[model samples]
Target: MIDEQKQQDSMNNEPNQDQQTESSESLEKETAAATPQETEVVAEQDSVPEVETQSVSEDDNSQQQSTDTTSTEELQAEIQNLKQKLEQEAQQRETVTAQAKRLAADFENFRRRSEAQKEEIKQNEKRETLTKILEIVDNFERARSQIKPETEGEKNIHKSYQGLYKQLVESLKSLGVSKMRPEGEPFDPYYHEAMMREPSNEYPEGTVIEELRAGYMIGDSVLRHAMVKVAAAPESSGEEENGESEKNNSEEELA
Candidate 1:
């Protein structure tokens, strides 16, 4: 009976021992799963400090680039200012040069006008003096034509006057004075004044038949006009003359 009682106690103790072992195994598995989670959380916390330090470094670099950009902008502004100043100076110089050229051109034109005016005054004075001298020559010619030598002494005096007149004419001719003789030449209204129109067969129509008074010229300008007679168209025949007589008689009868 004591042996049977010891066997029953041993069985009950065996069941208690088995249950304690299962409980200890479950606690060990829970500790193992919690260990990996703690290690992961520690790794994330350590990486946070490194990320913050990198962000601070990037901010510093950006500030330095901003300072460099400010300096470059200032330099560009200064260069632009200098360029504008040079352009203004060049424009001012061009304006001054143009004004100087205009002044010089105006002065040159004034000088030319003054010279032309002086030359015109000189020509007018010369023409006035020459006209007075030509009047004196005309009087001398009239006196010579009216003079007659009847005695030997008067003949010598006339000859001496003729020599003086010839010398005067030569002097005037040397000074560009020239006499015009329109006789037997084509009539020029500018140089010749027609005193009468005479019908003639000896000369052509519109011809200067005779010069009653002398003409004179200096260069290409007429100084005096020649008093002249122009030739008219000749009568065709005796029949035309008789017709003109008959017409004149009819006109007289009407009168």
Candidate 2:
């Protein structure tokens, strides 16, 4: 019995050894196949990462170029806007300058016109006042010519009056007033008023034979016209006498 049991144990142990060997050989074959497939997957993964890195780099370069283009366009627009604003400012400045110059010219013209009007008014008033004063001077001159002084008191008064008249004439002379001597001068309608006409052998026709009233001048202007007598051709008395004699002879023949 001991030998049989030993033989049986030996047989069991031999079969177990053969199964263990077969299982180990199969596991080795599967491991070999899986190893190659795993290597292939790892290689594909590596190649994928390289492609993705190249695409990302290209995208970054394109984004940088687009950003540069956008920035350049913005700068050009800003430059154009600034140029338009500068043109508008220049036009405004020119308009304001023109308005200022025109206003200055208008003001200058108004000032000159106002000054001229004021001067004309002042001259008119001065002439009116001087004309009234000339009337008083005429009265004084008439009084001096008409009054005669015989007594000592009368002579003294007359002398004082004459002195006053001379002083007044001197004052008028200093004020640009001057007397006109129309006697013996040609009669001018502008400066002389013909008060009377007289036949005179001493003066030629159209000549002033006598000054009835004194004329006056202020500067080159006639202040008062001279009242004058203009000379005319004398009528022939011999012609009038011969006409009368011829009339008497005709009347005697008719009788």
The numbered model that scores best in TM-score is 2
Model 2 lDDT-worst window of ten: 246-255
- Alpha carbon lDDT of residue 150, candidate 2? 91
CA-lDDT, candidates in order? 0.83, 0.85
Candidate 2: C-alpha lDDT: 0.85
lDDT of 1 by residue, 1-255 (tens): 999999999998999999999998888998788879978888888899899899988899899899899999999999999999999999999999999999999999999999999987987787788778877777878888898779999999988888888888898798787999798999888998887777778999889887767888888888778888888777666646686674443211100
- Tell me the TM-score of each prediction against the true structure: 0.61, 0.66
CA lDDT of 119 in candidate 1? Answer: 86
The all-Cα superposition gives candidate 2 an RMSD in Å to the true structure of 9.0
Error of 1 at 141 (Å): 2.1
Runs in model 1 deviating more than 4 A are: 1-68, 235-255
Error of 1 at 43 (Å): 14
Query: Which stretches of candidate 2 lie above 4 Å from their native place?
Result: 1-58, 187-190, 196-206, 231-255
